[model samples]
Target chain A: MQQTNRLRPFFENITFDRDDNELVLNFGPQHPSAHGQLRLMLHLQQEQVVKAHPDIGYLHRGIEKMAENMIYNEFMPTTDRTDYIAASSNNYGFALAVERLIDVKVPRRAKVIRMMLLEINRLISHLFWLATTALDIGAMTVFLYAFREREYLLDLIEDYCGARLTHSAIRIGGVPLDIPDSFLIDLKRFLDNMPQNLKDYEDLIDQNRIWKMRMENVGIIPTQMALSWGCTGPMLRASGVQWDIRKEEPYELYDEVEFDVPYSDKCDNYARYKIYMAEMRESTKILYQTIDMYKECVEKNETALMAHAPQYISAPKLDLMTQNYSLMQHFVLVTQGMRPPVGEVYAATESPKGELGYYINSQGDAYPYRLKMRAPSFWHTGVLTDLLPGSYIPDVVSIIGTTNIVFGEVDR
Target chain B: MRRYSPKDNVQKKPYYTDRYYVAPQVPKLDVESDEEFASDLAAIESKFTVSESYIQLDQLVVYIDIADNLGVLELLRDERAYTQLSELSAIDWLAKDGKFEIFYQLLSMSRRKRIRIKAYIDEAQPVKSVQSLWRSADWSEREMYDMFGIKLINHPFPKRILMPDDWEGFPLRKSYPLQGDEAASWYEVDKIFGKEHRETIGAELRDCAKVDRYDTERFSRLGFEVPKGADISGGEKRKKVQYQEDGGVFLIDRFDEEKTVIIRDKDR
Candidate 1:
């Protein structure tokens, strides 16, 4: 039977064509396993999915539109809302793009502090992914254990920035404040005990039969398909591609840090999970290195906070209160904002999820003429429509969980 | 400590001169330079126009004519091995040429290099879609269509992805208002539920509204002025005939009782 789009005289429009033995299921928009408002329309032939169409934008807030209207500094807080899971990464990425546009050089100590915050954010984000993905695959113990460590990291972030989730701790030319003295003590403690907590998480699900059965061979995507679909981060790395922006592009002080990019040829859900766990361990190593560098800075009595460019970067609050010239500079920076050069630049950081980039086109204005956020999750979500067709209905949950698609970045 | 001046050469800055600030090499590709890549692309087709190319912050950017976007992208992907279409986005240039500049950020994994392909199209003209080449272009092109209203010709499914299907104008355009426009008023909550069904839900809604009204009065008495544009009347005008039977769920309305409790507690 041929499907027809014939108009009816007195009836409302019918959307789908009637077919026998075919079921259409709306998987999300409000399903817990869907992970943050992703709605997939799955066409199932009995139990196997025939076709899956992702219906995104349930969380769209027009963040790019908002960026154009606000001043440079004013938009920093809004970047926090883009990928709220790793807000510090989003902040640093946006700041890097603006700093590139204006050709500003950050202080050495500021760069170290920024790198420390970014690695800490990576730990927080990967832990959340582990907890949520493990729970989605029926390992409830891993979820409980992951969140416990995540809480300790969030507390350290809160002590530094006053906000736990949305810590807009980075400024354009540097970081907003110096790391509190207690932050070093607390972070050192967390780093000391992190390996044991990771071991606990691994002990729960690493060797379990059920966990292996569900995640080992399911949702297998090859290296070529992953690349063609623009899969970055662990998804691309899981397919045996050693493309990490931190190593390749080396933004900030990442070049100074020594860490390995983990990859696996399995190219399945299990490989992706292992890559996330491996990444967390590497982040811990990076954290220890940063802490040592920070101690060196403290011993040398170095200024490890904001940059010294008074014309472009804002002055510190203490300086603004004391000096007349610093006060005027702060007032101008807050009100008028700095104007970047008339050109375009794309700055990318290896975010917890993937290569989170900000492409800014400046017309020498306080606000960007155009700001485009190339969120890694946006491309990862695009691959789902191609990935879910051959898999079974039950496997759909595992595939979605493995992709780690957060709607905040996908919809922004 | 020395004060830095913008007039000073950037190379003289201590931050820029630091040993840790080594500029990473843009990995060697099959082609020696961007010129070789452009020449190779031009060799594939005479219609391909490769304009002035520059290195911005260590990444190569190439400008291409809008008409040969697909041809150039195919050459870059198939022959040159820039497999990943990392990002596809549009920039609205309303103030300048009244044109929209579309950017395709491509990455070559084999070479570990990034190149940006840019094509400028007028607001009305449609750019050929590269969805056939890169599957990731599907959503990114849809986003361009949704945000800037720049149509991508031959796109598989050209429906609005971010905005509602019935959204009037593109929000990312410079001309579009930041706070939204008249189309926002088109969403009527009452219309979502039909009039017959709305009356059934209307009674419960009114009870909530009555509580809100009581709180508004209490707040005003406490010297807090109602914010402008606040619905202080609490949807009273939109309310239908109230259902008379009370569920008697609340022994006393919380808003009303709170006022008396505050007065008595102050006396004590």
Candidate 2:
């Protein structure tokens, strides 16, 4: 009888025909540092990578196709699934697109609240990036510390909305709900404690010999390469482009607030680290301004968070309860949905990862005729093919860590 | 609860109708309204024949010939400073126009403007690849080809990006059903179990929470576990599930049924 091999299935992918030094290693799909469902096909000659091909789509949910079949309001919840760590950012990006299509000016108070939510989301997303990237680079303590602060920030977010992670907090034309009675106070406490916590994170890993050794001179993306690859947000900023959408094209309450768009010419992991740290500090500054604005607006007793465009926006709770006309309209809006203008609008917002844009094409229908999500991760993932070659195998993890891609956005 | 019905072609069926619903159109202005757009359009018209140019929602949208895509983008990149190829994809209009309107959204940081270059191509025409110009288009083009079944002429790696290589249908097409066609529904079964096993295995059980007490393969009786395909026309006695056995383990504390709390609230 022939001997049965126990490891046959494991060896099935290994090719018998190959050069002695050259090898092709499938890096992920199950790898912990893959972030989410990223399978990197790396061709290695000895220890250095010869060529890299990223085989994505492991997390593809066909959400764009699903969005085409859904109404605008129904699709808002699904937007939270993309770039899920910063769910409200996706929510705002979609909301901004629909609001632009409907041509409704959002209330000033709602704008303040939306800005607060977005900045808080940015903090959450960046902290998560910091934690995971640090862990990926072999700094485990920073992960625990960063997550501890993240939990507090999540509590603040939960106080505003009912959910923590996938917060479909923003609605078309305005925010869905106003800040709770305790929201500002909680936000203040969290913001007050944030600087010290952020400094703690920096003190832990930013100066560590091993962290610097692993980070510096690795994954250097030149300015031209960054722009050509459509890199935005911190990725572009770190590569010496001072383009911040909030600065260039101010959406929401960004123009009212003052903050610096930090950039560095180093264009490597270390430079990106410095930029991320600087951004978090800048977000804290933005939050302070939003809180001041929110307090000032609250004095006028402006409780109308949702815009007054009834045909485009849903009826307020008070209207739904008191008026029969509002009830009928609400029923229709929920059943069929609001039909935006028969045109196309592409709205881009600077999400923590990059410029998250939603392009909506409406053909005089309740559902979008074509909804294309320009996810930053999709392009960032594409850049890996160019970024990975000639670098050592270990640098792949550092490069991916700095890239900060969430597969939900990449595979959508 | 609603009665169970087949959802085979639900999208095709008329479910809700709003006869009074009026679709509003956003105003599109002339390109000469803005001096920058006028100059840009003039520059574009000097080299290639621009079919149409207009400013919609404050962004310049220009329609050009399909063949001039690469050249126009190159001109914009080198001369016009439109550095980033923000997005590239096709809108499926085969049902209405029998053509795909492929659009390239170009972003110029220097000019602080976004210009959309769109071109119409026939259903079977292979799109000219712009991967040579902007590296971002590599994946976006592959994804466009994958979703809409658009053919590409000069893409470096001309394979499916989002979908599997052997997938049967272009899912983003208007005619393809959202839940999928018959071939799509059986894709996993056809790949893993072969077509011969279709009758034995049946279609995919989509309801995640659906539990059939008789299905021995998936649903196991908590304490009174049984063999596969065992005759269960007659029910077995329900055994009490415990944290510890009746005899109790050697080193563990004695089982306390009264102290154990069971959660009944679904929301909690």
Instruction: Report residue B180 deviation for candidate 1 (angstroms).
Output: 1.4
Docking class of 2: acceptable
In the range A192-234, model 1's lDDT, one tens digit per residue, is: 9998988888888988988888798888889988888889999
| Separate DockQ for every predicted complex | 0.25, 0.46
Candidate 1 to native Cα RMSD, angstroms: 11.1
lDDT value for model 2: 0.89
Model 2 spans > 4 angstroms off: A1-20, B1-14, B18-21, B205-268
- After TM-score superposition, what is the CA distance of residue A41 in candidate 2 from its true location, in Å? 0.7
lDDT of 2 by residue, B169-243 (tens): 888888777777777777888789999999987776644558998888778888777788877779865655566
Whole-model Cα lDDT of every candidate shown, in order: 0.81, 0.89
For each candidate in turn, the TM-score is 0.82, 0.88
Q: Candidate 1 chain A — worst ten consecutive residues by lDDT sum?
A: A8-17
Interface RMSD of each: 9.5, 1.8
Give the TM-score (vs. native) of candidate 1: 0.82
